[model samples]
Target: MTSLDIAFLATGAITVAAALLAVTTRHLVHSALWLVLALGGLAGCYLVLGAELVALVQVLVYVGAVVVLVIFAMMLTRAPIGPSPDHSTSRLHRLLAAVLGAGVTALLLAVLLPLGGEVVARTPVSTTGIAEDIFGTWVWPFEALSLLLLIALIGAFAVSRLTRPAGEVRR
Candidate 1:
């Protein structure tokens, strides 16, 4: 097999292993670290697929900002850093989840494999076109996302303030 095929296989394996670890790890911090590895593997896959912009954004936005925020929130809330509380689901629930996941996977494979052959023939649009479409047709959603970020920032600030010692009142 080609080097590219080998690299893809290796990355895919790492991604799956990291994902499994993230779900199965009892320690909250260890789970988050495994999640970071899984996300990094995804970025590597994006790079392999020749989507450098997507890869960079995935690393920056997901690994950098979102994960950091999650870690900070965990610290702020004084969540137990030790093993998580035992919260095993019933066997029936596990069976249902497995069946649902299998159905979704089969459906996606059926739909996507047929469409994949057509994607190679299409000419890629310029980055500017993507920007214009987002700023023009999707302006409202873009603005809403910005507003959501603002609200999150305000909420974080409010929560941190509330958690502070009562004797240290803000001016």
Candidate 2:
């Protein structure tokens, strides 16, 4: 195939491998780090596909904002950095989760495969158009999402502050 196809395949493989590692890892912080790698690999795929704006957004939103927020929340809640026996699932649970994930993936493929042949003739969307659509039409929803994230950060901080030692005096 072409160079772009090869590049995309490489990036996709990296993304999939990183995602699998992220899910399977026992260490909490390591999982988040793997998630960052997966997201960055996804951005690389977007870049290979010539979606620079989408790649930028993927990096900024998912890698920079979401993963950082997740790490912060984890730290704030005092989540275990290393492996915890309490978080381990039984073999049956793991098997069932894998089966469910595969079933959903198959279902999605079955539904979407039929639409693959219906190619619509349309002009390529420009970065400016997308920016306008996001900043102009979808600004309110974006702002609301930001507010929700801010509230979550505040909640995490509040929860963390409430778990002080018995001997510690309140301010």
- CA lDDT, every model vs. true structure: 0.77, 0.91
**Full-model lDDT, candidate 2:** 0.91
TM match of model 1 to true structure: 0.71
lDDT of 1 by residue, 1-171 (tens): 888888888888999999989876778888889999999999988777666666786898679866776677677655578864454566798799878888999999999999877746657766577557766897898678557756775666567656567688543
What's the number of clashes in each of the models? Answer: 0, 0
Question: Residue-wise lDDT of candidate 2 within 1-171, one digit each (tens)?
Answer: 999899999999999999999999999999999999999999999899777888998899889988988999999988878988888999999999999999999999999999999988978888898788888998999888788888988898888878667899643
List the candidate 2 regions with Cα displacement exceeding 4 Å.
117-122, 164-171
Looking at candidate 2, the ten consecutive residues that score lowest on lDDT are: 162-171
Candidate 1 Cα outliers beyond 4 Å, as residue runs: 86-88, 115-119, 122-150, 153-157, 160-171
